[model samples]
Target: MAFPRNGLTSAAPADTRLKLKIARKWTSAEGIVAIDLTASDGAPLPAFTAGSHIDLFLPGGFTRQYSLRNDPRERHRYAIGVLREPGGRGGSAYVHDRLNVGDLIDTSRPRNAFELDETAPFSLLLAGGIGVTPILAMAYRLSSLGRDFEFHYCARSADRLAFRDEIEASAFAGKVRFHLDDGPEVQRLSLDRLLAYRPAGAHLYACGPSGFLDAVVSRAKPGWPADAVHREYFANAAPKAQSDQPFRITLASTGRSFDVASGRSIVEVLADNGIDIPVSCEQGICGTCVTRVVSGEPDHRDLVLTDRQRADHMTLCCSRALSAELILDL
Candidate 1:
């Protein structure tokens, strides 16, 4: 997986799978579990950026994307923190209840849409609840680069704060602040005051629930440049696209045409026709299924893509075409 140009690794194999063994697993917080996975064959795992996440193929045919929480420079093992979501679609529940150390698991190579900007003069890291997974990695990278950064973590209570001890013990501990709803008055998060300081050319990165990210981005606006504010949403914020009209997609390569019916994604329609596109986190949170749009307007639904990128690419898993027909560079 050597790259002479861009610093990126390729797909795992023809199967698109990386077999790994759980090196360690432990409870990180009240409802969070930290896991470390190493290559099953004992080789160095592929490198990953700070905000990268891998798709974990779990029992019962469930696939979930988990953020890498360990330092990006470490290749001995990949670390991820999972918050037990009783109401989720069962991935976290299986991890907390059945997964154990030494268990062999299947996963995809690391992929990152939430990449860190190492060139920024200053960084503002914000995390709410489990959203800290990516922010924690960013903090590790920033600290290693000796880049100035301020980190703020918010949780409902002190018990829910994940990696409190580990983060505080870090070299950049002095740059971090934790806000708990039940903690002291000064420790409570005040978004207004927290976002008031707008350093020139400073970049802000945030991840968490849709509401939390929405608040942070909405508040940062008019103060921070649109391109300078980066975020990764844990859940898809946009509701299921309401348009039920069927659309046509033309492949630029074979000059083939297919009609994507309502309620079915472009990826599904293509696969049914014996065409497959690599995909993960079908909810549009990950860019695994992003495809270039040769022509036609797209009804973008993904949370990761900006208004600008929507003009050229679309996540086939969720995004659909606005025009009657879309020409895609398949």
Candidate 2:
């Protein structure tokens, strides 16, 4: 299955179903496990740039996205760090508890939406908790390209910091700053101070909890150009209260009508009526379920769609109709 150009896809082509053996696995930090995957036959794996992530197809019909944390320059293997989320839907738990070295797993070809802008005069990287996975890859690529950059890694504690020793020992060690929540007030990250001075042609990239990303973007929005600030959310934003209202949906292709009741989603309603929509990350973080809007206004609950995209398309999984009725391209 070919994925849309929008970047998220589930049914990839056969060749894109890259299977790799877990070459190594070890604890990287508190509640974090780092797994290295290499081609089963020891051939070079697919090449990916910094900030690229692959969809890991785990057992029990679970598919999860994990950022490649290893240096992209190395084509031999891909490394990903998994943080065990006790509250999550069980993907991380399966990775930490069941996966082992020498096991083979299927993965999608690398896809990247959080690409690094090499043209920027300077770059500031902000990471919170396990969000450092992709940012670490960017730091390595930036260092190798001799680009001007600084990385601020924030964690609840020094012990909980993943890849702390590796980062501190790297050549870019001087350019990296560690911020611990348990530290003194002066040592904690000050978003205002860090983003106070916006340099010419500088760009800011952040990933972490939704609140952390929101804080970074919120602070930078007033000073920096909208295009200069970029972020990726590792988790879905908190859901709003149970205020969903029933809405009508019209399929532009077939002129079919469906009713999406309160506490339900467009995808669910359509699927129940024998309509299939490709979807991943039903919480709306991934762009897989985006569909074009022919008419009517959308509630726009997804985090992946940009301002421009939202004008024309909406994520079908979680987003609903703001208007009484919505017409979808289907």
**Best-fitting candidate, scored by lDDT:** 1
Per-prediction TM-score to the true structure, in the order listed: 0.93, 0.87
Per residue, candidate 2 scores C-alpha lDDT tens digits across 228-259 of 88787876665763458899999999999999
What alpha-carbon RMSD in Å does predicted model 1 have with respect to the real structure?
5.0
Name the best candidate (by TM-score): 1
Off by over 4 Å in 1: 1-14, 183-186
lDDT of each: 0.84, 0.83
Worst 10 residues of 2 by lDDT: 1-10
Which regions in candidate 2 have their CA more than 4 angstroms from the true location?
1-16, 183-186, 241-243, 251-257, 273-275
| CA lDDT, candidate 2, residue 241 | 34
Clashes of each: 0, 0
Tens digit of lDDT per residue, candidate 1, span 228-317?
A: 899998777578665767899999999999999988889889989988687766767777778899999888888888767787999987
lDDT of 2: 0.83
What does candidate 2 score on TM?
0.87
